[model samples]
Target: MIRDILYTLDSPYRAPLEITGFRFGKGEKTVAIVGAIRGNEVQQLYICSQLISKLRALEAKGAITSDNEILVVPSACPYSMNIGKRFWAVDNTDINRMFPGYDRGETTQRIADGLFQHVRGYSYGIQFASFYMPGDFIPHVRMMETGFQSTSLANLFGLPYVLVRHPRPYDTTTLNYNWQMNQTNAFSVYTNQTDRIDEVSAKQAVDAVLRFLSRIGVVRYHCHNGFLASVIDEDQLYSITAPDGGIYRGICHPGDEVTRGDLLGEILDPYTGDVRAPVVSPTEGIVFFGYAQPLVMEHAILYRIIRRLHG
Candidate 1:
């Protein structure tokens, strides 16, 4: 196992932000796995750490294929993580949104640029990503509809679901989208937690990546057969929003199957202790995301259901 610094940013008031990567085997850059671009993504970083340990063991056993190199970057924004901030500490900007970045641009952009310079040409790229909102959900592999995405390729991860998201204008600047634009097949892997750690889903994520590496001939590790994976479009999810800001109680959790008109959750008036709104399922399907936080705001997304496909 070889450890190297992929990028660095000096700080006068704090330790230099160092993006470090671990390399296993030698030759072609077959795959690159990144984690924790945002500070709050503790689960993502933990998953990558577990993966690195697994890879180190595999490397010791000569399990990695010859002429195949894999890079694992555990975290990209350590400064924010140190301070428990979600974005760049200085500017409050997202590194992910800068993408194929500019060296002469802002701090986050330069960090993005420096990182991208080192990771771009790999055959496959995997990012352990977190959701924009805080919630617990079924683990899935997500891909951008960048005209270069392949559900078949994504299924190799063997996760339960594959989400193909249509890119909005802002998505053009994201790492996953830009990676595809540069002819590299990239995927974002989401586990069940973010700020907190869940052992089951973390192991599941590590196993999924190992499965993919084995399938792609990069490693000799044998793993359990994961799901065949159901593909869903991002726009097709049935979203349930909170009717009013209040204390929330979700009866249904992620991966739970619900029937149409089922009372999935309820919102209570914090002051009156009365049920103010009952969130219901409109269609029969699995809950992809379930509200986990105790509080909710009016019109905030509470649930996103994946409707079952017909024969």
Candidate 2:
């Protein structure tokens, strides 16, 4: 395993912060895997570490295919992680939103620029991504609907779902979108949680990456076939919103199958224990995402369900 310091930011009063990459093998076709871009993505970092460990063992055993390079970056924004902030601690900006960036621009942009320069032009790019809102998600692989996107390529991971998202204007600056614009095939892998680690899902994520590597001829490790993977577009998801603000008492979790009008959860009065609103499923489907926060705000999105298309 070769450790490369891809980018470094000097601290005014402390040690310089570095974005490090652990590279394996030497070759023309490269696969770049990125872990945590945000500070609070504990599960993302943990999954990458497990991937790195497995890759290291495979490398020692001569399982990695010759001339195929794989790079795993465990953490990119360590400063924010150390300080317990989500975005760049200095300017409160997201490094992910500044991708394919400018070296002479702001701090986060420069960091993004420096990192992008090193990882671009790869055969495949995998980012262990986190959701913007705090919640739980079923393990899936997501791709922006860039003209270059290939759902067949995403299915190699064998995750439960392959989500194709229509990119908004702001998405043009994101790493995955920018990578596709630059002629690289990029996909984002979303595990179950963000701030905390879930061992089952983390291992599932690691196995998915290994499965991809094996399928692409980068590695020769034997592994089980993950999932057949359902391909879904973002618009097909039905969102359930909270009607009143109060303490959330969730009865349904992500991955649960629910019938239409089933009682999913209830918002309760914090002091008196009276139910403020009873949240129910609007359609027969599987839960794709569930709001995990204990407190609920009025009109906030509480759940996203993948509705069945047929009766």
Off by over 4 Å in 2: none
Per-residue CA lDDT of candidate 1, range 1-311, in tens? 99999998999998788999999999998899999999989999999999999999999999999999999999999999999999997889999999999999988899999999988999899999987887887899999998899999999999999999999988898889989998889999998899999999999999999999999999998888899999999999989989899999889999999998999999999999799998888899999998789999998899999997679
Query: CA shift at 76, candidate 2, in angstroms?
Result: 0.7
Error of 1 at 97 (Å): 0.5
Which runs in model 1 stand beyond 4 Å of their true positions?
A: 309-311
Clashing pairs in 1: none
**Each prediction's RMSD to truth:** 0.9, 0.9
Let me know the TM-score candidate 1 reaches against the reference structure.
0.98
How well does candidate 2 score on lDDT at residue 131? Answer: 80
Clashes of 1: 0
The lDDT for every candidate, in the order shown, is 0.93, 0.92
Error of 2 at 66 (Å): 1.0
